[model samples]
Target: KVMGILPFSAPSCGLITKTDAERLCNALVYGGAYPPRCKKEMNGGSLELQFTDRSFKVYHECFGKCKGLFVPELYTSPNAACIQCMDCRLMYPTHKFVVHGHKAQENRTCHWGFDSANWRAYILLGQDYTEKEEKARLELFLDEIKEKFD
Candidate 1:
């Protein structure tokens, strides 16, 4: 599952342009001089975004009844790849799709886009750390191994 779904303000309806995709990616990834890897794919009526490091596959509604609606209120099913988000449940009372990864000792890592209104980041022993933690750890690790370029 991808992070939180941000509402598209433009009148193009639910359609996302290339520029919008890039901007959103940078905002989510947060790189000072270099941004993370993001690939936008137009799959039928949905816009799919794949982020490299985060291992997220985000799907957005580009057409149909959910047009102009980001996230589009999910419905629960018995699918193996679905897990309801605790943070998003207060705002959206529905189950969300989830994907599991083999890395990190085969833990169930979930992604959530951080919206100021839905900012509830938590870190469990088996769960992914909050963005703040990730950023801090990343900076420390990078500093240890980074090459000085003059």
Candidate 2:
């Protein structure tokens, strides 16, 4: 099942551009970067998501204060004071979607986008699958997304 859906977008002047989106998708699918690593850091109790070119450092304190997954770039602006965080719910195995065989729950919107200056790709999280199975699933998903742009 899909634990999370991370949509990578390219926004220019606060608007998402198709060209940028396609470019981002291409670089992500073809780029020789290592697979994303999501794990807790040993030194700090923070969660780090090492994606293609950038890393998302989510501090432990932010987890409780900020709702959902916090991507600083997506929220904070140079002049903005309040950090707009995504709203997410803590789901268990007994959740409605999980119990009904749904891959992901509906109405859960969590996406990360960037301006033209920076390109980023977020990892898709899955649950209840073996490592091999999860890897195959991710590969298949990427192949399908690449096909859309091609």
lDDT of 1 by residue, 57-76 (tens): 12221111011111211212
**Clash pairs of candidate 2?**
none
lDDT of 2 by residue, 5-71 (tens): 2233322346544433433343344222111242333355433332222112121111012222222
Using alpha carbons, what is the TM-score of model 2?
A: 0.19
Top lDDT prediction, candidate number: 2
Point to the candidate with the largest TM-score.
Answer: 2
Task: List candidate 1 stretches off by more than 4 Å.
Answer: 1-41, 54-133, 138-150
- Model 2 misplaced stretches (Cα beyond 4 Å): 1-113, 116-120
The clash number for model 2 is: 0
For every model shown, what is its TM-score relative to the native structure?
0.16, 0.19
TM-score of 1: 0.16
